[model samples]
Structure formats: C-alpha cells, structure tokens
Target: MATFNVRPDIDAAVAKLSSTVGTKREIQHLPEVLWEGETVEMLATGVYGKGNGLLVMTNQRLVFYFHGVMSQKVEDFPYRSVSSVQWSGGMLMGTLTVFASGNKAEIKQVPKDQGKALADLLRQRISEATSAPTQAAPAAAPAGDIASRLATLDQLRAAGAITDEEYRDRRTKILDSL
Candidate 1:
C-alpha cells in the first residue's frame, strides 16, 4: 500500500475530530502512480461530519455535501499553497479562493462559519481513501530458468526498471543464450 506523510496540523485535526465525534478515524496517504513510465501525483482527502455529510478536497477542488444536499463548492484551490485547514460549525459554508497576488484568502458563503463540520468530514474521507488495501501480496518469483527470467523481465518492465529497448535487447540475449 502507498503511504504519505501527513502534515502535523492535519494529523492533529484528525485526532481532535475523532475524539469530538467519538468514532475511530482512519487516515491515508497515496503515492504517485506510474503509467507508461510517467509518474502522476494526484492527492485527495475526505472527512465525515456529524450526520451523513462529507467533505472532500483534492488538488483541484473542494466539495461539501450532506445526503445529496450541496452546501459548498470551491474550485482551483492552488494545491501547492494549502498549508492546513480547520473546521467549526460555521467557518466553511461557502467557496474559498486564495489569491497569490496579495497573499489573501477569499471566502464566500450563505452563512459564514457554517462549514467546520464539513471540513472535518472531508479530512476523514481523505483518510479512508488512502487506507491500506487488504489484498494478499503476490507470490515470489520462482528459481532461475527461461520462464523465471521472462517473468522477472516482465515484472521489471512493468515497474519501469528498464526501457523498452533495453528490455527487448536483454530478452533477445536471454533467449539466444538459452
């Protein structure tokens, strides 16, 4: 399973939330996945509120809802600048955009300070999404042989250990030397 180092403040917030809500909290951090030898980092987190509400935050968006009722929507949150977030009953009811030009945070809401619970809920969601998978580990490679070498080569290629050209060259050499 992937792991992430949670910010100290976020970790503290999660702890406070678990105690306040009287439920066990789960946290997760996901590493970047590789596709076609390219690495992509996409981070998201969630928190569950007092009711059935949820708060979700990603690199690009922040969404809050309860049982399908839309309470808040914020977009383009400048994923690079987010330091930490806190929740209270009324602090998160509207959209928030941080402006880099002036180092200011702009918040819009129907009633200000109404989104604390929602923020907490989103933190929880992120925690759950990043939790470790429960599946069993794959079996180890067998003893060295044509089949084993081929399998190892395939695994290495899949893990981006060698370029396609290098893999093809090594595979040809292995087969010829056999």
Candidate 2:
C-alpha cells in the first residue's frame, strides 16, 4: 500500500484551513491540486453522497475532496461554470447546494456559519462572473480611490490571489479610465 505524506508548511496550512469546521481526516492532497493563482477562502466539513470530505472555497473554484480507503474523489466547480449557490442552515449545521454545468451538487452537514458565508460569497462571485462580459466598463474612480484600488489589485497579483490575465485585464481597465 502506498502512503501519502504532507510537507510541514502544507500541513500547517491544511491545519489552519480545517480549524474552522474541523475534518474527519487529514487532507494532504489539497495544496497539490490548487491552481497557481488560487487562494483558499473557506473550508467546511460535509458529506456528498456516501463520501465524507471537505468542501473548500478558493479564489477561483469550489472544491470537494474525499479521501477513501482505496481511492479518492475530487470535484471542482469554477466560478464561471457555477450558476448559483444555495444554503439552508439549521441550529448548528447547514446544507450547501451548488448549481453548475447542467448539474447540481449538494453537500450536507456543513457548519452553519461557514456554510452560509461560503454560499453568499459563491453567489456574489457567480453573479460577477456571469455579468462581467455584458456590463460596460466601470466608470472612472476618483484619483485617490483609483490609486488605492490599483495598489490592492497589484498586491493581489503579487500574492498570486489573481492570475496574470486577470491582473492585465483589470490594469488595462483602470488605466483606460484615466
């Protein structure tokens, strides 16, 4: 039998990610699967079908990973592919359902607070992604506001929170407003 080992830094990151909702097992494979510019935003424990795993929200996608005895499962829903997200919370737990790519994924037993926050954030991102193409270019911001936004955008790019293409597109839009 082959075993998987996690590096120290990634182990720490996984621990921090699991702190909020906890986990049934160590998720060492997560960092290895993230895109170059992706950043973890939230994580919750849940069950999808008979598999129990972690529901992870990143800057670019929603990822569900389940590590089973003989195999593993991973599913990712990108922001652009997602149509909508819904959350229903009980006293302590919630269910998060994601509609995307002609299908729906339902994850149950998520922490109420984390699930609600993840659902709201996913909805907002989906809205922005779906509406961005048709919307007119943003109006020019005030000089000071523009400076602040530009700085923040630059930081995001530098920190790998946003991809190079995203940085260039946003930078062009900001510069065009001037």
Candidate 3:
C-alpha cells in the first residue's frame, strides 16, 4: 500500500475544527486531495461566511469548508482570480476579507496569530497574480461549481439572511463570471 503523510499543522487544524465539526475522515483528508502538490500556507478558524467553518489557504487556492451536524459544503477561490484581500477588526479579533472572481467571503473573528499572517500571504499572492499576466488569469470554474454557488445564494435568500435584491445581484454576478 502507498501511504502519504499529512502535515502536522494541517492535522492540528483539522482536529481543532473537528471539535465542533465532528470527526469525518474525509474532511480531514480533503486538503490533501484538493491541494495536492500545492502548499497549505495557512489555516484560520472563526470564519463568518457560509456558516462559519475553517478556512484553508494554499499556494494555489483558498478553500473554506463548513460542516453541520449532517451537511457539508465547500467553496474554493483560486489565487489567480482573487482581486482583493483585506484585513480588518481589532487586536483581539481579526477578520480577513477576500474578493475573488466577483465573490466576497468575509472570515471574521479569527485568532490574531493566523489572521495577520494570512493577510500578508494573501496580499503577496494577490500582488503576484496581478502583476504577472500569465498567472493573473485563473482557470474558469466548472459549470457545476457555478451551479453550486447559485444554490448557496438561493439558500441565503430563502433563509432571509439576504434580500431578494441581494440574491438577484449575487446570482447575476456569479453567472456573469462564467
């Protein structure tokens, strides 16, 4: 059998998330598959968007995974498509906001240690992607990916977290990117 090792930091992050997210073996192994051959740069908790899950940053993409008692969802934002990365909040609670391919994800109330480092790394990657034309254009997301995003917006609207206007606007933007 061929066996591969998972990074200790990633194991720690998964363990941290599993306290509330439960021990899903697949979830623990997701980063390894999704970011194969890529570097897992940072891992931050206390994210506020898409139901507050763990945020995983890699050299190639930013992937957020949220798990409920029985449901699981993930969102991926490629570095090449990212246009803005902002850091905010106070010393005690930091927030990281990433804008990519017209989608915005705000990860709020992150721990101070990971927040600053994530912001710096994101800024550097965004800058590099912006300056280099070859790497600036990220590959288009798959059609199924767009469909899932639209579904998420619809869920947000159905739950009354967003207005009908907001849903329409976001849906339009997601579609336009395809």
All predictions: root-mean-square deviation over Cα? 16.8, 10.7, 10.9
Ordered from best to worst TM-score, the candidate numbers read 2, 3, 1
Which tens-of-lDDT digit does each residue in 1-178 have in candidate 2?
A: 1123454444444554425333435356677677887777766788888888888778788899887778778899888767678899999888999877557799998878778878988898887776765555457668887798799998877755555667788888887787
Residue runs of model 2 more than 4 Å from their true location after superposition? 1-26, 135-178
RMSD of 3: 10.9
For this target, which candidate reaches the highest TM-score against the unseen true structure? Answer: 2
* List of clashing residue pairs for candidate 2: none
Worst 10-residue lDDT window for candidate 1 reads 26-35
Per-residue lDDT of candidate 3, residues 86-178 (tens digit)? 888696778888876556778887777777777888888777765654323236878988888888987866754455666688788788878
Q: Per-residue lDDT for 6-85 in model 1, tens only? A: 54433433443322221122232211111132222222222333333223344333433333233422222333233334
Stretches > 4 Å off in candidate 1: 1-61, 64-84, 88-113, 134-178
TM-scores of the candidates in the order shown: 0.23, 0.63, 0.58
lDDT of prediction 2 = 0.74
